[model samples]
Target: MNQRVLAERARRAIPGGVNSGQRNVPGLSDLVIAHAEGARFRDADGKEYLDFHAAFGPPLLGHNDPDVNAAVAEAGNGADLCGVGVTEGEVELAETLAELVPSVERVLLTSTGSEATFHALRVARAATGRRLVVKFQGCYHGWHDSVSLNVISSAEKVGGRDPISTGILPEVLEATLVLPFNSSQAVRQAFADHGADIAAVIVEPVPHNVGCLLPEQEFLRTLREECTKAGSVLVFDEVITGFRHHLGGWQAISGVTPDLTTMGKAIANGYPVGALGGRADLMDLFSSRPGGPAFFAGTYNGHPAVVAAALATLRKLRAEPVHAHVFALGERIRSGLTEVFDSLGIPALVTGYGSVFVGYFMTGPARTYDDLLRNDANMFIGYRRRLLDHGIFELPLNLKRSHVSYAHTDADVDRLLEAAAVAARQAGGEVQDLAAASTMGGAVR
Candidate 1:
């Protein structure tokens, strides 16, 4: 059946015809996938496209990797969920994380990134005896009330504490201080006003959710230093940047460590898993013994099959040149697309690092959410639609960044660039001369 029929059927059972609101793009056609494997997936319509979404940054080795599948099968054969027990795979996976991630001395496994972040914040509150938490304007931790403010907004209210959803209590919104990302002055001001009551400061070391905004080195250092001085927990939400940016996460790349780190996306390849780990003293709050205060428990915290897949993924990542390979592909796509858009006289900017990349239909480099306002979202979405028509599966609908997997070959990159050229031409218009738009305060690079 067609996607329309499937979507109509889904709407009868599920709200908005989707499990998540953002599953399908706002004004785009429904994308129903039939099956996916290795660098590509076939949609319900039987059309196969080269997959750059990579299931939203989890499939670093690509979809359905043989080793990961084999490991999953082996672990699945062992048990599903022995409710009152622990699995050897969980132990091995935790050990691998402790060894790989610099900040992870102890780990508490959860089912999703949202759960990990929620518990991490709870641990922070318990450790510091504080109620308020600080998160940057566009750095998304998860859907939890503590972090559901100012993550996604239009250009006008980009820096305010605006909750995207309605059900979040005003008290919860008040507890979160949303500051402009990459602005140390704002960070200082927030701490200056509420440092005493601040329980934790959580951030995505690299803010990929807003189309890949890199944190200024000094900005991150300032966070580290200020949190140190205030005795507040510094939590790095590395769900998107964990293994994709590096095996040790962006902390390894930046040399700035957090007291607690929450990661999931690339942890178990593409399996359902999330981990909250950090300094032993702080993580000790999760101990449910006679003395411990914080209670953290989940039935499928570390499912055997998922942990087994994670273990296998970690082994392969350690043994292979995965980062080098994927980074090259990412850079190629970035530069190639930038060249394609530029040559076609389309005002565009490419931003990202390592294995993740995104293109904005704006003249200037996007540093903050406000800066991203200059982007032509309509044009960007139209361009991506043209690419989809050309049989290239990108992050559908929105201008979310693209994930380059180790399974993507040089030929894949070439084909993507080729498709991008066509898309750029189809979406092209009068060349935007930043030199001319400068009078209007539009800067270009």
Candidate 2:
């Protein structure tokens, strides 16, 4: 079937014709992916495109990796789901997490990143006996009530209560204190004013949600110091940065450990798995014992197949040169895109950490959401949309980072750069024409 037929059928079944709100972009929503292999996927119309989105950075090793798939098949042959007791895979996965991640002395498994963050916040509130939670403006922890506000807010609502979705209670919105990213003073002040009432401060170490607002080392250190001084739990939501950035997580690079860490995305190489780990005392609160303060239960928390996928993915990451390969490709894409835009005389900034890149239509580096306020949203979106027409697939949305999977090659990087130059020229010409037309109209007046 064609994309149009599939899309029409989907809209009648799924709300908004997409399962996730982020998948509902104009150019992307209509696309029906027929199949995906390493580095590329084909649409229902039988056209192939080089995939840089990597399904929002989950396919770290790439789509349909044989090793990961083999592990899943092997594990599924022996065991599936036994909800009553723990399996060997579950114990091994948790042990592996504790061994790999720095902040994890103890851990709990969940089915999704949202569940992990929800459990982390609950543990923090219970451990501290506090009511308020702190999060940065552009950092998205999860879709949960506690950290759902102030992501991608407008200028007027930058520092205010701008809930991403309706149906969140007023009390829930108020409970979350949204502050600016990369501001040491703002973090310190929030802790000073509400130190006694604060339960936790959660941040996305790099703020990839707003297309890579690189966190200052001092800013992260300030978070650690203030949270320590205020006796509040510090949580790093590394769902996007974990495993993909480094085998040890972003904390290894920054050396600033959090009281709790929530991780997912590439953890299982596109399989459904998430984990929350932290200081042993704090994690013990999730125990179902009589005196345990927090509650945590899920039937599919540690499904055998998911655990197998994660174990296999982590093992491959440890044994192979996955990080080395992807990181080099990431740098290649960033530099290539920078050269392309400069040649076109288009003001742009491409910023990201290992294996991720985001092209921002702005004048300078973005340290915070406030800095990103100057980003040209229309040009950003238009450039990505035009890239799709050139057979390169990135989510045509503002503030979304593109991923480089281990499956991609140096040749693929060069092809993307060549296509990007053409796309940039097209998008740039349209913007220039619009500016000229506006100036001429003003002169006539």
Every model's Cα RMSD, please?
A: 4.2, 2.1
Worst 10 residues of 1 by lDDT: 427-436
* Collision pairs in model 2: none
Highest TM-score: give the candidate number: 2
Per-candidate total of colliding backbone pairs: 0, 0
On residues 219-275, what C-alpha lDDT tens digit does candidate 2 reach at each position? 999999999998999999999999999877889889999999999999999999999
Give me the runs in candidate 1 sitting further than 4 Å from their true place.
Answer: 429-445
RMSD of 2: 2.1
User: What TM-score does prediction 1 earn?
Assistant: 0.94
The estimated TM-scores of all candidates read 0.94, 0.97
